[model samples]
Target: MASTRPRDGASDKGAARSADALLARMTRASAGRTAGILLCAAGAAAVSVALPAVLGRTLDLLLQGHPDAGRALAAAVALTIAEVVLNAAVALLAGTVGARSTAWLRLRGLGRLAAAAPHGVSRFSPGDAATRLSTHATEAGAAPAGAARIVAAVLAPTGALVALFVIDLWTGLAFVLGLPVLGLLLRSFARHSSDSVSRYQRVQSVMATRLTDALGGARAIAAAGTVDEERARILRPLEELGAEGRRMWSVQGSAMARSGVLMPLLITAVLAVGGLALADGRISVGDLLAVSRYASLAAGLGSVAGPLGALVHGRAAARRVDALLAVPPLAHGQRGLPPGGPGTLELRGVGVSRDGEWALRGVDLHVPGGRTVAVVGRSGSGKSTLGAVAGRLTDPDEGEVLLDGVPLGTVAADVLRTEVGYAFERPSLQGATVEEAIAAGAETAPRERVRSAARAAGADDFVRVLPQGYATPLEEVPLSGGELQRLGLARAFAHAGRLMILDDATSSLDTATERQVDRALAREIRPGTRVVIAHRLSTAARADAVVWLDGGRLRAVRGHAELWQDPDYRAVFGHADASGGGGNR
Candidate 1:
């Protein structure tokens, strides 16, 4: 249902604005490094412009047999060294700022995804989310430094042009004549580069998404003998991805090639005009050399293309990253339940919609504390959705769920988590070792209690026999489906709160083992309010009562023996009640 949450209304303009704000925040977070980059770049540009002017003065002084020639020449050398040092500093600072910003973005983006809840996060695929968090975040992180570099790239050429004007107006005007063409070339490259990079990155995500889906279902794919088909499906976007990549390089290459030819030609024209000025005694020999060098520096506008392209890619990636940020999380309130209250749960008019269809509607139910209720239904009958709602894994769209007379939404997060426990049909084992996996996320899961939980879930024996017993690394232990389920159950059991909802959590266990687990849960484990989303009639039979669901509605709540008297309820377990029932009459 979280996967079907419809993206919570993200518009293009809104996401872009959010992306802009995120980039701005990153820039602000690294303000010191960013300012250092700007200072170094500005200092480097100042040295670049100053070097040629200083060298020209040195040349004039040496030719005139001036005694100050040695000092002038030394000044030029000093400016040259300063330029290199400052440029190096800029590079170092840029890398540091970029790295810090990337880490910050990843943390915030990851936190946002975590707070969104499992159901809400299903909107993004594993691959898509990974790419957004990893690749796109890295690209977006460079935006702050990229912007600073761009200012420096522009400032250098602009300063050179002004210096040229100071040396000779005619030479400066000659260089200015080609500015329009340079602008056009850069504009075209930027527009084309932005389009191609966006397409390329999007296709990369598509392939990654397909690849992740296939990897998750690898066993099934092999069992179905469709490995080749899946390979083809996953790689289907590679061709388009390649095309976009080539187009990006083509745009960049074409612009660079054009600039390569145009820049030298403009420099030649400026030099020729400066030569004429020299012949007319309008400028000296040193002035002509400075004019030529300044013309080349002014024409360095072409070099801006590289950094500008990076900026475009980063901005596009920011949009992708900010889209993840735009997903609103499941908000919780600050209210806590009353002390020592039994975990009675109630749902009133609860409705959950998924992809324009109601998965659960008008479901009003209640369960007293410390009792087990089996929720039985057809596959799509909202049993799991109800479990999620009961524990607030997801909030209902139209109604409220209450625990101990307090709205679940209003419960403080820590109190809510400590009070409700859940085990999933396919739980992801967390942590590095068997013990840690069972006690994952708990602040203080004593080792003995962890062992007790594992024993109750029937995982203790296997864990103790492992190469290192409970200390065995999870990677070193190959677990079957049922074993994995037991570990998940143990995790839940270790933290049995006032309310525990098992959403088909025992589905993978063998009959004997599952029966043993159920018995242990009732006797060996601490008791709690239990809501079991059951697909097996045996599980329902063992519960105090059954909550039957049919087509998104609650049909009846009765003891399993009583519900079995209804033909429709029998059909839910793939039976007919042929002898003594007429649809619960």
Candidate 2:
């Protein structure tokens, strides 16, 4: 059973480090956008100072018994309008910059994950990866937007306080005195609240995973009469996620409430002091009003601490992205392959392991170039592992796998992929049309070659009957298992590589279509250099040589006719006589 316990200290530390790294990467990736946003924030701050300064001057003009006090009041009003306009412009600019930066970060991070995630990692489920990319990227984006707001909010108030000080230094002193309390609030909230936020994010991931699993296996669950049970299992995680969300919100709400109380209370104190100064004639009424405005400004800064907290959260989220980015990909393969005939394949003490399980044991095998070889094995017999090694999908753990006397690891991956094509047992098609799927990753092949390959794979007839034939989009079209297999075969044929490894590629097709494809492949393919991993005895029986594997080791390599004589071999298919034997290999 899977463990339900949450991760512990070491894991949390690693996650935190990863989150930090993600933020650093986001900073680098969005540097220009950040600069643009900061510029807007600075402008917004400057505009915010205009209103208070102008209002103070207008009041001063009125108090001096200016005959044109009305004009001065009008000027203040106009300045206030101008300040609003400037604030609007800056807000728009900052929002645009933040949006574009988020897009770039999300796109690049997702692309890198898709590319680097295929090798080495064993637990990168599609559902989990999708959740990480989507949720983490969204949370990370909040940092920049929040940072822009925080910069403007902190600066406008701070600038107002400085201006107030220039008018009367005591007011500035009062503003400065309140900052220690604000700092305490920030530190306390951040230290305690960050963990809750991280916890909420983790719960969200678990909920996403469970939801994806339940939806993807809906058919299976219904058929097994476990729909209600599966639904409960998925909903349980979501409930846990909701509880975590509530806890975080409660913490945030309490911190915000305390900050809210402190800000206005500090403003009231400043007002009382300013009133005493005004009554004593130590400060003019205009100066008292300005000091009041500054007090309000400081209180406004306290409110901004909320977005500031969001900025920190966003930075933490970006750290997750950074963790993924820092993981190095497998080194690029060499540039070329050694010149040799197509079929000269050899394995020298090769082995492969994944997550501590030896997928393939140390084994040596050599097959001379120019003949069809069949690999016969039970399920989990390392048959697919051998095919993967031969195709260079992965590197071996212990020893060398050579193609044409050159170690596969030394040959460039692109070249290896081009020269050694794989037709998987259930090939993943990646195109709108049959032709497009066949032409995938084979840039040099022409449309005519794609057609020829389809015909060779016995796929031409069904394709011709489609609404648009080669132009028909695959999305709306339904294909049977056999038809899909034929399409996979068409891709292999179109590739025109020297070494072709078909891993149970014909298993789903009827015997007639299967034989037809086999015959076509035999005639068109370069006569010797083919490896067929098959569960069908009919396919193996036709190969030039059959290498039988059992219990992770190769037990025999001989002609099908010779193998038929072995009682153990015959017994495998539950056959008493050679001619009577017919079953999946």
Candidate 3:
């Protein structure tokens, strides 16, 4: 159920705000570097202007056989060298600023993503998120540097215009006349290319998302013999991406062609005007050469097209990064749980909705401390939703969840996490080694404790046989589904929170192993509340109590032995009786 449609207007506005915030952050981070870059560029422009003027004076002195010709030549050479050095400094500083900014943006984006809610993070596919972090981050990072170049580019033309006027009134006027045409061309390109670039980037993200989805499910697609269909589906966005790219290029090409034609004509007109002035003895040949160079330099401002294009692309990319950052995180209060309380859990009038449909509604349940409760339901009956709310993985839209008499939302994040542990159906083990993964959240957990937990979860024997035992790298050890599930259970056991929630965490285990693990949980683990989302009837049969849900409403909460007497309850598992004992074995 990933969203394939483009974002709506309100989301776009939020993204714009995020983009602005990011730009502000970049500006703050690199203020000193930005200042240095602008200073160097200004110095380079000043030197560039002085060079042509000095060269013109040298020419005049040589033509007249003046005694100061050598001095003028020396001044010209010094100005040329100064310009080169200043330009080089600008490039070096701008590059450094860009690199630092890119690093900062990527780190910030990742931090924001980590803090965002699970549902919010799910909006982006893995590949799309990677592109935003890598490619889009780099592009957005170049904004500060590109902005500096743009300023310098504008300054060059302005300085050239001033120098031209200083040389001769008629030549300056000739250059000024073409300004409106160049401005119009740039304005049009900027307007057209911004939309084109934004669309192109969106299409790129979509294509990446589709590709990542295909790769992750490659085995399934191949087994189903639908490889061709999957490939076509993944590549479907390429056609739109190409069209957007072509539109951008066409806008740029048109601007360049127009500027190309207009610039030479303007330069030729200025040169013709200078010639007329020279023939009338109003200006020297050196003056004519100086004015011509100034006019060309000013006309070269049209080449700002490249940097302007970068600015546009970077702005669009920043918006994409900002959209992810804009996802509001779950709010947690500043209250800490009271000390020395039993791990009692309660849900009062709890309700949850997804896509405008109720996943759970008006649900009221309570589990006393030291009791094990099983949540039983058929498909789409809110079993997982209840587990998630119990662990505060998500909060209900209505009512509240309480642990030990305090609302879950009121508990501080650290206290809540350390007190309530969860294991999912498909666990993500994220660490370098097996031991590290087990001890991930509880970093201070002792090695002995980890081993004990592994044994309790029926994982220690297999782990001991690995190449490096608990130290074996996760990638180097290829584990089956059941093994992975056992490791996940071991991780939860190692943490040993006051309240443990296993949301179908034992589904992959065989009957004997699961029963052994269950027995170990009862005998070895600390006494606390345990909420298990059970898919099999046998699992429910073992629990002290069962919370039966039907169509998002709590149908009953009673002992498993008592509930089994109801034919409707047995029918949920498509069974006549609980005599078979082994469910999904």
Q: Which digits, one per residue and each the tens of the lDDT, describe model 3 over residues 461-529? A: 999999899999998989998999999999998887789999999999999999998998899987689
Per-residue alpha-carbon lDDT of model 2 for 1-585, expressed as tens digits? 121222222366776777666556666676776676677667657766666666777798898988877886887787677667766766776566556656766777666664452443335445555655677667677677677778777888888878767766776776678789888887777777787777777676666667777776777888999878877876777777788778777777877898888888888877887887888888877778778887887677777768777876786566555555544454545657656556588988888786678877876888887677888777777888888777676677888888888887787757776788878778888886767888887464689888999998999999999999988998766988788899989988888677889988998999999889878878965454778997777887888898787766778889888888777776555564656344334
Would you list the rank order by TM-score, best first? 1, 3, 2
The number of the candidate with the highest TM-score is 1
- Candidate 1 Cα errors over 4 Å, as ranges: 1-9, 577-585
Q: Pick out the ten consecutive residues of candidate 3 with the lowest summed lDDT.
A: 1-10
In candidate 2, position 43 carries an lDDT of: 68
lDDT of each: 0.87, 0.74, 0.86
Candidate 1 per-residue lDDT over residues 255-367, each given as its tens digit: 99999999999999999999999999999888888887888888889899988988888888998888788778889999999888778999999999987999999999989
Residue range with the least summed lDDT across 10 consecutive positions in model 1: 1-10
Candidate 1's TM-score reads 0.96
Q: Give the range of the ten consecutive residues with the poorest summed lDDT in model 2.
A: 1-10
- Tally clashes: model 2: 12
lDDT of model 3 at residue 316?
85
Residue 514 accuracy (lDDT) in model 3: 92
Q: Model 2 scores what on Cα lDDT?
A: 0.74
